[model samples]
Target: MKICHVNLASGYHGGENQTLQLIKQQAALGYELTVVANPKSPFVAAVRALPCRVVLANHYFAAHAASVTADCDLVHVHEGRAIYWALIQKLRHGVPYIVTRRIDNPLKKKWLANIAYRKASAVVGLSRDIVAKIQHAYPQLSPYKIPSSPVTYPIDETEVNDIRSRFKHRFLVIHAANMLQHKGFDVTIAAAKALQEQNANVHFALLGDGKAREQLETLAAGLTNVTFCGKQSNMGSWFAAADLQVHPSYTEGLGSVILEGLNSGLPVIASRTGGIPDIIDDHVSGLLIEPGDSQGLATAIMTVQANPQLRETLCAGAQQKLTSFRIEHTAELYQKIYQEVKSSL
Candidate 1:
């Protein structure tokens, strides 16, 4: 089947990465694929080598007029702005489209937005939390649940060794995400400071860069335990060298990094918030703490650090949880949805 995937996100993030994974998997299955993206989106570069056409659409208007899906059997909308583009295609040309909602945030309660969602062949959410939000915002709609999957990147052992060398004899805790306000960087910093006061032999390597870096850095000033490593390209190496991964987001659609950490055989301690509980079973797979609780975060960190058997158990549980979230399984589920939607159309 031929498919046109539309994602007009301004920058590449977790959602874009998931789109890339789906496109790659479908391409392997011999499906002709086309991607409609903003001209500056890093998603364009990421799929350039793949067996698919990448069309540039500066805005939703361009996306609608650009004949992106003339030869495609179906459209997959990966971002919000692209919904209208797909809706237009369906109305004007009878092109069936599927909307994949990735965030737990509620949709706008506007008439046009509601119509756009209602017109889709199917609506997919990355987690039950996201599906519930969509249903709450649009009671007439029933969104299907299709989750994001764990990613495994190639690891250079030398790079891994280099990272471990920098923080010798310290129990390293890695927190990787854009330093956005909702991501709870402030909570991680507070926990790091608390750990420092206790003279704990633990360190935090904060990964990724965003608008909140300066503010977070200021908050972490004079704390020797926290190091902000901005946007490293070799994430697999960093995951390899870290003792634990912490995701303290106050709210998350689904923590893709947590999946990656689990795939890397790393134990995780994350907050009990949106979509996180779906991925982790507290005390079974990984530990969970209340969002923005620095004291709780610090105590959880030390709990894992003090108990080697618990770490082993968590890692073992993490591996078990990962089996259900493999990219291959996610891709096959998407293909089934595509077939069902297309047949109904």
Candidate 2:
């Protein structure tokens, strides 16, 4: 089957990474695939290295619509802008398309989103929360909830060991998100400060770069225990070296990094928002704190650090949870969705 994946963003993030993985896995299964993105996009370069065709075009809806509709059998769009373009292609060339809704933001732009939803043949929501939002915002569309396949990034076990050896016995905590206000990095910093005030010898690692980097650095000033590692290509080492993964985001469709950390055998301490509750059972696999609660976060950290057995228990439970999100299992589900769409066509 000929499939076209469309994303308008120029940067690489969880959604782009997940799309890349799907394309790679599908290509291995002998499906014809093409990617539509900006010419200078990192996604374009990344997809180019794969065994699929890459079509870089300007943001003009007409240009992209014409190009994609003429050759692709199915268009799998990643976001709102891509959905709009796909809608145009469908109207002009009768091309069927699917959309993946990846965010759990409030649906304040309902009218605009509903228009695109009505045109899509199927809507793929990354989480149950996202699906509910679509249903509430545009009930006419009846979007299906297809959990985003768990993300898998290449990691070297030997490298993980090397990193862990250097940070020996240090209570290391990592927050692997782009420095952003919504990501709640400041809350994490506050929690770290609270721990430090109690004379705890803990280290916090920030593993991404974004607009809030400078601000976060300033907030982390005078804290020798905090290290902003910027963006690392091999983040698995940080995951392996860390005692806990902290994700205090205000909103998320699904925290893929949390899953990655769990897969690496580290327990998560995240806000109880979006599909986080779906991934983590509070006090089981990980601890859940309310969004923006620095005190709650500090208490959880102290509890986890003080009880070694609790940490081991959480790690074991997290490993067990990893079974449900295995990459191969999610790939099979997507394959089934493709077959279903193909047979209907």
Candidate 3:
């Protein structure tokens, strides 16, 4: 099978990483793969390192469609903006395309989004809830649910020990998201401060960086329980050492970091928004609190930290539920979608 992944985002983030993992997993299965990405983007660098063909185009929608789409049996659009390029590829060249909508945010310019999905071979949402949302917005289209890559690496013992020794709190929590408002940086900071005020033996490390760092830091002034550990390249080590994962995002398509935490055998307490509930089974795999509810978040963390048996139960549940989110598993499902798109040709 020949597949081309078209992404226009310049910077590599969660969605880009998920696309890279998809291409890598499919390439390993001996399928022909190609990527259309920005000439200077980090994604192109990673794609070039693989066996796939790299068509360096800022937007394959207008300038490079003929070069990248003429021969490919199907194009998989990896971003919202890339859908237009995929649409052009299909309408102008008859190249079939599939789309993966990775966010729970309401679709803007509804008519345009409708046409885009309507033209695609398949619409994939990273979470089932996202798929349901799409269905409600555009009932004519059938969207599938395919979560992002799960924890693919084993825990590095050395790195784990290093982190463990550094932040030796009775309970170590990891809030792994870019420091942005929607990611709930304020909520995490408040929860951490509250936990500290209550004398809870806990420490939190915010693992990713973003534009909101300075503001969040200012908000968290004088709080000793939270540490901002700038952008981390290797999250596996952090997860391996953390006792619990706290993700209080205001919105998310599917929280990939939450999956990593569960796979690492740590409990998670996340906001009840976006695709989080898809990964966390409210008190089963991990606890769930309403978005922006710092008090509830603080309570969940304290309760989990105080009960070792509950921690063990939640961790065990996480392991049992994590298999479905693995990269290999996700790729296998997309492989079927690719085949279906190809068969339609």
Q: How would you encode candidate 2's per-residue C-alpha lDDT over 152-231 as one tens digit per residue?
A: 55678888788677566678888888888999999989988887768456778888999999999999898877888898
Better of 1 and 2 by TM-score: 1
lDDT of 1 by residue, 1-345 (tens): 999999999899989988898888889989999988988888898888899998888787775653667888899999998998888888888899999998888788788788899898889999889999998987888788888998777899999998999999999999999989999889999999899978569999999999999999999999999999999788899999999999999999999989999889899999999899988999888999999999999999999999999999999998888787888888888888889987886
Query: How much is 342 displaced in model 1, in angstroms?
Result: 1.3
Off by over 4 Å in 3: 60-65, 110-112
- Model 3 residue 296 lDDT score: 93
In order, candidate lDDTs are 0.90, 0.81, 0.86
Per-model TM against the reference: 0.97, 0.91, 0.95
Question: Positional deviation of 4 in candidate 2, in angstroms?
Answer: 1.2
Which ten-residue region of model 3 has the weakest summed lDDT?
A: 59-68
The residue-by-residue lDDT of candidate 3 on 1-345, one tens digit each, is 888889888888888888888888888988788788887679988999999988776764445547676678898999878998888777887889999999887767577677887888999999877898888888888889999977466568899899999987557888988777899989989988888879557988888898999999999899988888999887888888888899999998999888877877888999999899998898789999999999999899889988999999999998888888888888889889988888777
Structural RMSD, model 3: 1.7
Candidates 2 and 3 compared: the better one by lDDT is 3
- Residue-level lDDT for 18 in candidate 1: 84
What is the full ranking by lDDT, best candidate first? 1, 3, 2
